[model samples]
Target: MAHGEGSHNRNSVEAGLEARGAELTGRLIKVVLDGEALHRLSALQEADRTQAVADLEAENEFSPLSHPELESVLHLSIQEGRMVFDIRDSHETPLMAIVLAMGPFKMLIKDYQMLLDSYAGAIAEGREAKIQAIDMGRRGLHNEGAELMQARLEGKVMIDFPTARRLFTLVCALHQKL
Candidate 1:
């Protein structure tokens, strides 16, 4: 988990979220994920505070999680060694649970952790140059993950790239916890 220096990094990550959350935007009103599944995946869960901020950012999509009486929730979980996306509507109706094999993202998850570690180290050592480089890698990896997620959810859930990116970030958060 990120401590002192890491705190700054974490806040910057969600800084844009608070700024954007003031408005009623985006499709989902909330996203839910439990710790049981996360614990089952790994004993390396990040601090709850960091996890909450990540979840909040992902759910809010940097914008407020407000919309019409349309679909508004996605329940993320893991079952039978696979990832489950249990999406629900405003009335809490079952939309779809896009189940995906965890294998495909295995490498990405590993890379994500590496980047997080590298970022933390860079921050700790005050290596601004390294941090910038790591940030670029983070963005590229995020885009790649988003594209993969979109392809996997094809014909199932129709969401924009940014939404998919947020969802993928959510997935990364889950990976940290996932």
Candidate 2:
């Protein structure tokens, strides 16, 4: 019984160490949105642009446990009307780079923008019903964008729904800059 207990304890310690190693390697340490890609966002109305910047800087946790190859720093940019994801390790060595065509996202983004404009107008006009309806549409479009992003990234990277939503926001911010 004593020998069996010793073996079990050793196995537990080994498992703990493996888990810790995975945690350490499968975390995103930083995320950078390219300055050139952010130009469109800067063109937004002052208040809207400020809010967009704040949203980008908000705390975000990224876990690539499902795709261990992606456990690293991430940089986002837009090139030739496409969203580019450049992933790098802690040492700044490039891991993988993926470019997603912006075409598929155009309609959803446009709809979201329209909804935002409508919602703002409704707010200014003091129409609660219109605001609520527009808000619902905005959320629905946002979710759709996130789902499309997740689908586009399938097999390349794994991200949670909230992460996908935030990524969609970033994409919209970049689109605004354009």
Q: Against the unseen true structure, what C-alpha lDDT does each candidate score?
A: 0.60, 0.64
For every candidate structure, what is the RMSD over all alpha carbons to the true structure, in angstroms? 11.1, 10.0
Q: In model 1, where do residues sit more than 4 Å from their true spots?
A: 1-26, 37-69
RMSD of candidate 1 to the true fold? 11.1
Residues 15-54 of candidate 1: C-alpha lDDT, one tens digit per residue:
6445765322436666777445455332232453245446
* Model 1: per-residue Cα lDDT at residue 5: 28
Question: What 10-residue stretch in candidate 2 is worst by lDDT?
Answer: 1-10
Q: What does candidate 1 score on TM?
A: 0.66
Candidate with top TM-score is 2
Query: Clash pairs of candidate 2?
Result: 40-176, 40-177, 40-178, 41-177
lDDT of 1: 0.60
In candidate 2, position 128 carries an lDDT of: 94
Q: If scored against the real structure, what TM-score would every candidate get?
A: 0.66, 0.69
Q: Please, what are the lDDT tens digits per residue for candidate 2 over residues 26-139?
A: 446666677454554433333444554455345443434344534477787778888998888877788778899998999887877766677778888999999888878877
| lDDT score, candidate 1, position 77 | 66
